[model samples]
Target: MRSHGIVLHSLRYGDHRIIVDIFTEAAGVVPFIVPQSRIGRNGIKASAWQPLALVEVAWQPNVKTALQRPKELSLWQPWRTLTIEPRKTAMSLFLSEFLYHALRREQENRPLFEFVTKALSWFDERDDQFVNFHIVFLLHLTRFLGFLPNVEDWEEGCYFDLQAATFSRVRPYHIYYLEPEESALVPKFLRMDLRSMRAVGLNHALRHRALEIVTEFYRLHIPEFPESRSLEVLAEVFE
Candidate 1:
């Protein structure tokens, strides 16, 4: 089937080949090959597979096989605001990498699609703190991953255990637990929009602690994710 989509992220294969993952509204997620995508600006231009650039898409399953091929690709727009800002650019990189790992092959998730697109639109539109964007995105993403804990568990003195993906009024043995001050951000997080997320004035310690909780959350849910490179980079950006 033919469709339109955007390159979520890509990885280099060998010396020049590239394996591309794209999110298509019409066909969900698919991987494409940009043979020798690295060497020639004539083909992919510059950083074409970076993130969040809309593109033309073409797809069809191989006969007698589940794998599909995505061809007929090109960028739909320049992503002027997303590409130009360093802060937003970093967010894009972080989110795209996470999504590439989280979203599986041949799975269709319309709501997740819309959530990401809208969040990107929010970032593209205005300048804001950019400090707390990842933390807010982590909470919002809980809805898509099916791991959002009971937010009403925000009882005082309780600990948040990222491994169990739950909240208990008692302190957990895991050092990854969130202290009361950090846990207090939950209600505020529940009120955040992607745009308003930037304005969230979480203290540095709480913000870093939030990121740690979210990353542990990802580890529990995503079996394949060994580590997130964006973790350190995002911390520096927030700092």
Candidate 2:
């Protein structure tokens, strides 16, 4: 199946090889390798596959339903400014690593793909506070995974229970829950589509709160995923 996708990441397979992972707008996650990807300056080289680079991928299995490769390739973009911005670069790196492990392979997710593309474009355009971008991404991403929690799950001024992925007027059944203020803020973010760089109305403190919510949400749902290491640095930037 041929589709448009964004390169998520690439790492050396052996000594002189590259294993790249890409997420197609329609075809979830696909991974394949390129020979001699680590070749030096004078070799038939494969370009460095950076996170969020767009490409049209032609997926074909080598023999049966075994390992596949992209029969065709092209650069969607280079992300010039984003690659240079220290903060955005760190966030992108953290996000790519998180998705690399969490997103399953060969599933179809048009909405999630659309969200990520929107996010990358936002990173390219604006320079607003970004602590909220990941939080928004995680919230919106739940919809793609069929786990979108209803805001109505809690009435106004209630609590957001992360473990249950629900809401309540009483105390949370679990400790990792969103208080009233955080709950109120979620709907505002859930409605926004712009990137953090383009234009967003978030202060660092609110963004950090959102970040905490996001991490707890990840723990609630994605059991095996580890804690986000970039968050502390990201928090400092927000502060």
Candidate 3:
């Protein structure tokens, strides 16, 4: 079968072979085994399996096997600076790890796939003003995951209830809620896009805090969402 996918992450298998987790448009999230000989052949280097690298893959599907080997692979798009730029690379790494965890067991979700592909291209086109990208991405990603926070009651005195995924005039007694200041910002994120990112007034502190809130929101919705290791790397880069 022929499919297009975004490379989520790869693990070194034995010495020269590698196993790649891909979120494919046709087959959802599937693992692909790339043997030693195929890695560097036809400009498809092993390094090309980097996080969020778009690729067109031809592979045979077998009912008995979990991992499918690609017969043909090619870069779907050559990202100009995502891999080379420092902060962008950091953001992509964090996002890649986030997506791997978020979409690991997903079935074929076309809308979700389209959203991710469009967002990656958006990142590629933007330069340094993408500090809020991941936070925004995570916020929107919730819609697909089925826990998108409700900003319907967003007003001057409203607090966002993460656990209930709703907004309320009365503050929740639990800890899984955002403060007024933080809650006020949730409405902005509800309509955020890459084109409007530069207009956002977030500094390093606000960005970090927003990230914390969003990550916590994810934790509330997703069972056992572990602490992201790439987070520290992102913080350092932003600092």
Q: What TM value does model 3 have?
A: 0.94
RMSD of each: 2.8, 3.2, 1.6
Residue 65 displacement in candidate 1 (angstroms): 5.9
Runs of candidate 3 exceeding 4 Å displacement: none
Superior by TM-score: candidate 1 or candidate 2: 1
Error of 1 at 163 (Å): 2.9
Candidate topping lDDT? 3
Worst 10 residues of 1 by lDDT: 37-46
What is residue 44's positional error in candidate 2, in angstroms? 7.7
Q: Which structure is stronger by TM-score: 1 or 3?
A: 3
Give the poorly placed runs of model 1, Cα more than 4 Å off: 37-47, 63-67, 173-176
**Candidate 3 local distance difference test against the native:** 0.86
Give the poorly placed runs of model 2, Cα more than 4 Å off.
Answer: 37-48, 63-66, 127-131, 195-205
* Candidate 1 lDDT by residue in tens digits, 101-170: 7775536777877787777666677676667766787688878878777777778777777677667888
Per-candidate TM equals 0.85, 0.81, 0.94
